[model samples]
Target: MTATDVLFIDDDAAIRQAIQQTLQLEELTTETFDNAASALKILRPDFQGVVLCDFHMPGINGLDLLKAVQQIDESIPVIILTGQGDIGTAVTAMQLGAYDFIEKPFNQDELIELLKHALEKRHLALENRVLKAQLRIFARPGPRLLGGESPKMKRVLSMLENLVDTSADILLSGETGAGKDAIARYIHETSERSQHNFVAINCGAVPENLIESELFGHEAGAFTGAEKKRIGKFEHANKGTIFLDELESMPLALQVRLLRVLEERKVERLGSNVSIGLDVRIIAATKSDLKSKSERGEFREDLYYRLNVIQIDIPPLRERREDIHLLFHHFALIAAARYGRESIPLNKQQIGLLLQHDWPGNVRELRNRAERYVLMGPVALDEIQSAASVDTPTPQSLSDMVDAFERSMIQNALQMCQGSIKDTMEYLGLARKTLYDKMKKHGLDKAQFKEDADHDGL
Candidate 1:
């Protein structure tokens, strides 16, 4: 859906034209209409704008339209333009959730400022909505998915969710620190076989001379160093998952045996006649293109195809810039708790540094930076900017800084109070309705904080 700064609705054609001209002069994008019906027809729950409606419209009066807008999205700011005689109705509209109201013959500057604030609020609501959705996906036990809002990460989220139950083998393609190992573990943890063993091995890290024996457990006396019979990873992970990192680095000779094990769903111990039946799901990760390597004879083409049943490609941090802030924020929070420090949300300058530097190490690098920031504070960000050859970070508006700071404070208070609204209100010295309004404005759900408290053994 297209986004506008304002959805202007007034039954008076002259007033609509005048108000539209005034808003456009301030460079605000607006869509003006003569009646509430036409305006409501175009309104959407995801509309990234505010509604400015006249309280005395012919059909669907301002209060009724406020109700309709609330039905669509209560988070959307709705401003009422009321006549002096309609002050009582304006108050009623406020009671019904109008963002604010302006009396007739309002000062143009005041109106512009009001609209600007509303627009800023709308932007935050949309962004917070997205963050909340992603937060839920990573809220489960063990490693969180820590996915992004970018298109590529959204696709990854969909694939992971869809494959949580299926028994198909998975191949993860991504650069180092792009979280291939974490993704592999997430798949296994979320799958039906979570109760079984999850064996992870780095194909390249194992010495080639003993790699074969390491994979297909050797019987005693099978090798010069083999003193006792051993079970290999495949057997060890029976009815569970085996994640092989650096799959392309596995020796060609071993690839042949790996292919056989994958095909027959069985493994043979070295120098043993018994063939153990298997039920293992292989999740292989590679930093390079396995298909290209297979064609070049560096990797076995057959084994590549077998593991390629489903390949999830994780985009680098630079590629999904929109997700950088959220990822950094989450990591920072976790770091603060670990370090027993008061979590300090990133200011405009620090956020600029984070966005400006292209993360060569991807999520791992960002996570490290978060931990460092928690331990060292803003100086770490300055150090990062000095060491990296990146553009100066363009700062956010005052509104953004205020909203982020306010939200951070409210969230921390809620956590401290274990989501008790009364305690939080008292701690913040806010009236009950005022605190609730702020919470709703920032998309802070008390129940989530309560869950967090319970999980943390508070």
Candidate 2:
């Protein structure tokens, strides 16, 4: 355990001096209080150390001092050092929240060991409190996952509803910012484990060196700074769901450990021999193509297969154009509430501008734009055109300008339909063959546009 600030309370100066000298080797800061009244005056709630008080003091006994300390903050562990061997009184002290009791002439080794154990317990207790507080922030509904009148969306919601009963693993895949975490939370909230806990850990966020201990825990003395045996996310989410966002970023070595837990229903903490059972349902999400990664040897094939049991691919916001208006309205409403303003309108020009741009960052980008819209009002069309012109190729020749204009017109139409060739052709009043020729001349991949349209089930 970490060396902590310790306090010793006893009227016997010799005993106090002995304890102070013994603990000095451990580099623990110690304060000696000759009486309970003096100890009370110095005791503060922020003290992380344990208190060692003699059972019999001049005025208040050890049990009474423990009670007083607990009333201020029950978290601090109190150790009672008594000369008598009374089990009944010891039981009473235990009932009163005394951490542990030691008979007089306590061995330095034994005393140090008990103090280390008490410190570990205190550390875990404090950590749990902080984790619970952070969880409360995510307890409320997150950013909106709006839109679903299309068959694809309806089916997605139906699948989510079905998942509310079973403890089956769920896999979500799509472009970045597609709101995969939102769907994961929806399933967790509607599931039987809602009352337990829903722990979300981003595999891509943490450093590779620490990921294993973060997932499966670590034993005391396992490594440097492993002052105490720590409970990892798996044990923390014992009876609940564990959402692993960006699961593809997990290292192969860690993936092997994870696969074993998923298969054997148990996990062993790092540097520990014993295997502890787990009852957590895993929900893994990835923006990258896991199948591709598996084939490329970047991700484990068996792990991919395990996680892909119940897959739900969320379409990007650009593909799900029908949901654009709904998402915009939702985001606008949130912005209005946050800013304490009335409803702001997105006029026809604003709507047309939104329909023309391709959202590379998906729903997250769209929500950001909507919030920007609420704050900045409608953006100038000429400014957008000027921005577009800087990136797009400009031709000096009249013939080339005409060709560029034609390509730009077709591209705008394609973006409006989120790259649906059929819709683009219909909007442009052009034949499929002509659209094909124009796309070929512009060096465009017609298939890529068609893929997004098909992915959205357009």
Candidate 3:
């Protein structure tokens, strides 16, 4: 809404004409009316802008017009124009819901300023309605796949579809790059709450000090720089889903608050007197060994039990060798589209090499490698390893570090030959039985695990 559509009602044609000319110079759209009755007919809830009317009209007076406009829609601010020495009438107009009273022989500057303020308020009200409408679209289900249709991926999709309708809190456990977030998204997109928000927050990415406030919001003066009230994730996720990634990285204090919310169905916003009710279905994901963390007293035991009510451990890309070709094709096509280039198909050797490497960083690492390959031809083994290593932070102590390094190398060799001991040994420059012995020593299982009916033992 703009001040360009200002409507002026006055019995005198000259006065109405004068006001319109003056407003026209200010780049306003003006409509002059000799009678208030005709003006009321044109006035609507969708009126473009301000309504300026004369106080001493013959039929319906300024006060009567203001009352009628208010009856139609109270949101519209009606300004009453009075003649000189009509101070009592202007006061009466203000009492009767007139936004402002302008005396005749009014300064053009004053009228323009008042009209401008009213137009801004009207514009903001309309903008807020548009914004709320946009939010409704985001609350709906988002796109679910990057690509791929291998048997392994089919099983994952099957599991997601099976679990989507339930109200269970899912715990997605996987390696850092294993696409746990992708699986989480798939569940949310296919679930009953698909029409609601699916908000994701990285537990590890946020600083520990501000994590609580970021998740649960704060009131004005909650702390330094807390100048205004804020809504929290739990509140924002009402009747929706909240994905807490890197769940183990959340501080113990926050873990307690989260557990309480899960158990009691509410949360207390910081620096507030009251607790807010929440209806968010939580889907927490972790890349680390949560059992180990629980044992180390780094993660809360009660919280883990609560979250692990329905756990889904995602296998690394190397473990699902059959899916490599599918993943490669998926990434390749995505890369081509993103880079605006013709899609390039991978050779048998390229697929073989892709399957052979141990993707420590998981699906995310594979996607990055695919993008690199698309941009700069085939990537070298060292370059790919360096890329994966960027997220797989190095271990500190020598003994622990060496063990991790050895595990990675052995895992790579095993994956290279589809778990063939002889081929794996040749790749690792070791004997067949020696490779088997190392596999046993490292507690690496060669058995092919499948998602069974008793998968969660529920």
* Highest-scoring model, TM-score: 1
- Compared with the true structure, the alpha-carbon lDDT of candidate 3 equals 0.71
TM-score of each: 0.58, 0.54, 0.52
Q: Rank the candidates by TM-score, best first.
A: 1, 2, 3
Model 1 local distance difference test score: 0.79
* Candidate 3 RMSD computed on C-alpha atoms after optimal superposition onto the true structure: 25.1
TM-score of model number 2 = 0.54
Q: lDDT per residue, candidate 1, 5-87, as tens digits?
A: 78999878888899999987765668998888888898888787789988887878999999999999999999999899999
Model 1, C-alpha of 104: deviation from truth (Å): 35
Ten contiguous residues with the weakest lDDT in model 2:
449-458
308-424 per-residue lDDT for model 3 (tens digits): 888887777665554555555455545665577554655444654565566777777776777777777765335654545454443345564445445545654553343445556
TM-score of 1: 0.58
Evaluation by lDDT, superior candidate among 2 and 3: 2
Give the distance in Å from residue 217's predicted Cα in candidate 3 to where it truly belongs. Answer: 0.8
Candidate 2 colliding pairs: none
